[model samples]
Target chain A: MKQDSCQVTVIDRKRIELARKQMPGAEVLENVSEVLKLLGDTTRLRILLALATTELCVCDLAALLEMTSSAISHQLRLLRARGIVKYRKEGKIVYYSLDDPQVQSLIKVSMDQIG
Target chain B: MKQDSCQVTVIDRKRIELARKQMPGAEVLENVSEVLKLLGDTTRLRILLALATTELCVCDLAALLEMTSSAISHQLRLLRARGIVKYRKEGKIVYYSLDDPQVQSLIKVSMDQIG
Candidate 1:
């Protein structure tokens, strides 16, 4: 028999069972993975990090990043759809901000990890 | 003239300038995005989550996930390369665990956001 990298000489049944039970269901894992994928983009991550500090209008984000307003809007639309960001209209100018504490926490924790 | 979705009727130069200053450099942003991308995968994320709770050898993880040892080892190699996970050899068995507190924080915040 070919030696497998994961050779099971001593199986810790107790630990394995505990980890299996702790694992989230498939649906939740899929949902969380999708959110992480959305955030995996540099443009979107920058947008969220910028928004975490302060709210800005679409054009403001474009200006801040030196990117086109249209480009910024496209990413913002995706972020909004996922509830990672929220926007409100103030007399025709729409201001976008982090949707909730959860979004802020995500940004903070991820940044801490990379920094 | 076509109106852009991010039409700038009133420019907030101060906020825009502040946000620009606050934005991380390209290298840092790239690094963070890469980390997020790695965790974005369901298998890798699950593996990390499991290791977060208890240390497990490669075969242990394979059994817990009901996946082949080769698949689990593949993901572990990637995670190990990124410093997201660490492993130690005990005789012929290698045990894997989370590398740092940063990884734990990343998992917790992300789960909180999704939950």
Candidate 2:
């Protein structure tokens, strides 16, 4: 396949170096990648969007999205593990919400653009 | 495997109804998922971060990320198709940058939260 690159090989070392310096470190990038990957799924994204309005337990999410509670909870576990979502206990019931405001804004910004 | 859901089966119909009404449409959620999935890759995310500073050609992205121009171009094509990134022609050289301000903010928000 023909590579999608510039025919000329002029390397702007200074600009590239500046961007590299400004970029977050490897560990941070990895964490961000993991977060985005989790959010990429339709089910998970829907769950986050629903949770954005208010916290919901697995049953609530499943009912809202029309999926099984097992599937919703499975995704919630992954979200919690990644720190994208947090759970609180009220008696025997558990509610899950977005852990980071930044993530909430990420969804909001994305929705505004496409919606 | 055991499910990770609340044992209780009390569905808050009112809350779920409210959340469902407040959520974005299915099309928007799918679009957001596609965008997040694209950003989920480290190389693609790094390319976006670099472009966030300024536009660059595939060769420039390759040099910055230590990847081949072909690989960079491939990801760039995918990003362009999804409207996440845009490219312009300067003589014989082509430069790519984030296509939407919303996408730019998404990256910024993600960076601020995790960085």
Top candidate on DockQ is: 1
> Fraction of native contacts in model 2?
0.57
Lowest summed lDDT window (length 10), candidate 2 chain B = B1-10
**Tens digit of per-residue lDDT, candidate 2, span B1-115:** 1332434354587778789889888887888888889889999999999999888887778878878888889999898898889999988778888887878888887788766
TM-score of chain B of each: 0.80, 0.79
Task: Give the poorly placed runs of model 2, Cα more than 4 Å off.
Answer: A1-10, A89-92, B1-10, B90-92
lDDT of each: 0.82, 0.82
Q: Which structure among the candidates has the greatest TM-score?
A: 2
lDDT of 1 at A115: 55
Model 2 error, position B73 (Å): 1.1
For candidate 1, what is the lDDT?
A: 0.82
lDDT of 1 by residue, A50-89 (tens): 8877899987788777678789999998989988899999
